[model samples]
Target: MAPHTRYTRLAEEALSPAHSVIATSQTYDGAAPFPDFPDDDRPAPARSGGERLQVAVTALIVTLPFLALGLAAWLLWGTLIRPTDALLALALYVITGLGVTVGFHRGLTHGGYRAGRPVRIVLAVAGSMSFQGDVIGWVATHRRHHAFTDRPGDPHSPYRYGTHLRGQLRGLAHSHVGWLFRNDPTPVERYAPDLLADRDIRAVSRAFPALCVLTLALPFALGWAIGGTWLHATTALLWAGLVRIALLHHVTWSVNSLCHVVGRRPFRTRRHDRATNLWPLALLSFGESWHNLHHAEPTSARHGVDRGQIDPSAAVIRLLERLGLVRDVRWPSPDRIATHRT
Candidate 1:
């Protein structure tokens, strides 16, 4: 059977229905999810023209900013750093970062809540602006990660190498960014057939290229309009466009690399699930560093359940819930919290 078919048969019962509340923590184990394609290890196909174009543009976007920032730092000695441009980049970073945290991770992949069509579109576009992979692909890969975690099939596990000094360094590199160059592509059909089946989500996935162009161009245009100079446009592109994405990307990826191999496991989970809570990263990672609780209560609307663990993303979700933009939130219950607590 195809991956989707297998997933439907295996995961249908496991998945909480749209907007349904999961009352207990036992669902994750019961719903083992669509198993990885153990027998289907055929070589994947090459990238299409659009994919190649995206790769080229993404590379340019990722590189030119550093060069610009470096030259400005050398020649202008930090004088070129505009307050507005820096603030613009920070604003976009928060918006797009939360888009990934709330929309892509919890709302889509884990089904922690449901949003209306307008809210969904906004979230998708904001996530795309971050220049992460399109929503469809991102959701697929992340869902696969939750299903396998530190086990063999995880796309980017820091523990892939044994825990030794040299091995850990190599694993950190692999988990951080080295996995991008690998040939393996997570099969979307098996992991994210639900998202693929959604017309709105499919449309957003199809618009990733256009969204990338808009995101970069928006900052440049804003700078030019606001400051009225080619230099200001370049500066905006450097800080807000390129730097913002790079910063957010590293922070998000740190959850995969740093959170797993370090920090305190304050919650119980599966036997081999080595995810941990890295408090230092809580603020920057937008609450995603609480990986131990996340793994234990995959559907909980809040990851930072502890008294003082600040979860900005969860706060945003709560604000939206108050505004009636998102509904059926799966906030952790007292019993569920007690069950997972170490």
Candidate 2:
């Protein structure tokens, strides 16, 4: 059978009622039970001290880069942004963004391809620098997302509030960033057991904090080296380190929020899975906005399967395949693509 068909069958088996019950029963990091909003539109209950702390940290992570955007703007008004700063921001954005798309999401979460031990570890480390989350947790949460999709068990779904206008507005916020504040945790054991079993991946997951620091420090050091000044270093830190992160964060979150609510769905997915192909976000999101097809064939390495749809992540995977860095890629066949079409 084709890889897409095989993966679809496997995913269905994995998300069977028995497995769903077991997954929902377990908790990761001692998180509290996930709230059931239904269509009532009631406010979420109060959080505990630990949950409050988590929320504060998540808020800082979500907001600080946005604040940097304002600061960068102010700086730009007063002083022109250096070409080096712009270049550094672009470089780091592409690196960290591709790491998440290719490494964390496709390779680790969906088994899109297989790479050598060194390649796997490097990719994991690179993805960790994106500041989304630890590799294990990221993979686990995404796997759970695919399993439950837009249903009650989904960790982040824009349809959580129902199909009403008020609910959609609220649900969009919740799915985009508010879900980070919730205490709901996806169990790594249930969702990403293979990553947990891999010693290299475990190591990379554990080093997430250090990688976060490195991500920022590298830009600052490079800016200082290239421009030979503290001003250059500070500006690069703001633009490349913080602003770049903020942009990538919102772009990634848009796939969870706007893509579901807007855009075209050329492919059929599971019931309630309203993932869409958003053209505007294609370049920024590295083709992840071609989400409808992704949901249709969750394990397909290439998401932008149609004509004139640019998929940089798929291009990178093909490059890696040619370089012999990765193998067993699950590229979708034309027949498979046609089969999933609506």
Full-model lDDT, candidate 1: 0.77
Residue-level lDDT tens digits of model 2 in 1-342: 643334334444444334655343333121232337422325555788987886787788899998999998888886788888899999999999999999888787787887888887888888899889899998878877887677767889887767677888888999999888776767788776667767888999999989989999999999899989998899889999999999999999999899888999999987667899999999999999999999998888999999999999999999999999988989999998999888
Candidate 2 regions off by >4 Å? 1-18, 22-51
Best by TM-score: 2
Question: Alpha-carbon error at 44 in model 2, in Å?
Answer: 11
Looking at candidate 1, the ten consecutive residues that score lowest on lDDT are 30-39
lDDT by candidate, in order shown: 0.77, 0.82
Per-prediction tally of clashes: 0, 0
